[model samples]
Target chain A: DTAVSQTPKYLVTQMGNDKSIKCEQNLGHDTMYWYKQDSKKFLKIMFSYNNKELIINETVPNRFSPKSPDKAHLNLHINSLELGDSAVYFCASSLRTNTGELFFGEGSRLTVL
Target chain B: SQQGEEDPQALSIQEGENATMNCSYKTSINNLQWYRQNSGRGLVHLILIRSNEREKHSGRLRVTLDTSKKSSSLLITASRAADTASYFCAPFTNAGKSTFGDGTTLTVKP
Candidate 1:
């Protein structure tokens, strides 16, 4: 079984277009996260949710919002996407918050023109 | 601000050789974790070393933590081409936050 999965493996959109990426984890983890990996391969943590509660919210712009309907799903929605939004968005989950290993999904690549 | 920053942004070694990557972090940490990411793939957990621990081993991979120096090193023995990937270190603090570094790109040539 796929432990962590993200939908829309690839996304290509124009500037000002809004898009959403969905993520689901079956590991029964209490914490889920959204990370952005830039072209330089630098991974940055965007948001973190523990048991459907917002735990960590970095300095990400308001254009990006993360919603967790439950403990198993966390989705990211970008509004009026800009060119700088082009990168790989990864969904991860762990047994707890700020500790233990993280199981990551295959990642969703977003390319904005 | 970033917590952990790996040294030697990139390393290239031949197969059967040993590769070493170092990570330095600011402030104290509860634990440190190492992860690997292949091209176009997600990061995979490799090992985790706690603050009280000094050394840990998992198969051909060895990790060492020095809390006094605030540094850690990951050593891979008998590296193969398939081992080529970017290695990242995440230093987790007691305040419930961990930040990943830029990562060390290890290229094992066959």
Candidate 2:
């Protein structure tokens, strides 16, 4: 089974447009996360959820919203996408253990022109 | 917003050699993990060492953690061409929240 999977591996759009990235995991993990890795190679966590409930929402802009329909899926939607949103977004899942051994997705590259 | 940082932004070595990367964080952590990212793909979990644990091993990868110093190190023994990738160490704490370092870009010449 593909443990963690993300859709639209590549996205190129103009500024002010809206785009959404989908993520799903079959690992039976209780926690899922969304992370952004920019051109500087900095991976920062944007949001986290456990059991379809919100947990950690970083200091990210309100334009970025995360929706978890169930425990197995988490999706990110960016409204009025700006140039700064162009980065590789990754989705990961773990068992909510203190160890934090996350299984990551292949990433979705978003390029805002 | 302090996070973990890896030493030596890049490294080049020959096949069968050993590659070591060090990571230091600014905050206390419950555990630290190492990940490998090839090209622009997702990160692959390499190994994890808890705060209470001093050392852990997985095949060719060995990880050591020092909670007092708030640092960790990942050692890859007998690195091969296939091992060439960007390695990142993330220290998981309340504030850090499993953050990634800039990563050590490794090039193994076959």
| Highest TM-score against the true fold, candidate | 1
Per-residue lDDT for B1-110 in model 1, tens only? 34688988999999999999999998988889999999888999999998999999999999999999999999999999999999999888875577788899999999
Q: Give per-residue lDDT, candidate 1, residue A112.
A: 100
| Model 2 per-residue lDDT tens digits across residues A1-113 | 78999998999999999999999999899899999999988899899898898888889999999999998999999999999999999999998745378999999999999
What tens-digit string does per-residue lDDT give for candidate 1 at A5-24?
A: 99999999999999999999
TM-score of 1: 0.97
lDDT of 1 at B47: 97
Model 2 / residue B102 / CA error / Å: 1.2
C-alpha TM-score for every candidate? 0.97, 0.96
Predict model 2's lDDT versus the native: 0.89
Q: What is the C-alpha lDDT profile of model 2 across B8-94, one tens digit per residue?
A: 899999999999989999877877889999997899988878778999999999999888888888999999999999999888875
Measured against the native two-chain assembly using Cα atoms, what DockQ does each of the candidate structures obtain, in the order listed?
0.70, 0.66
Taken over the whole model, the C-alpha lDDT of each candidate is: 0.93, 0.89
TM-score of chain B of 2: 0.94
Tell how far residue A41 is off in model 1, in angstroms. 1.0
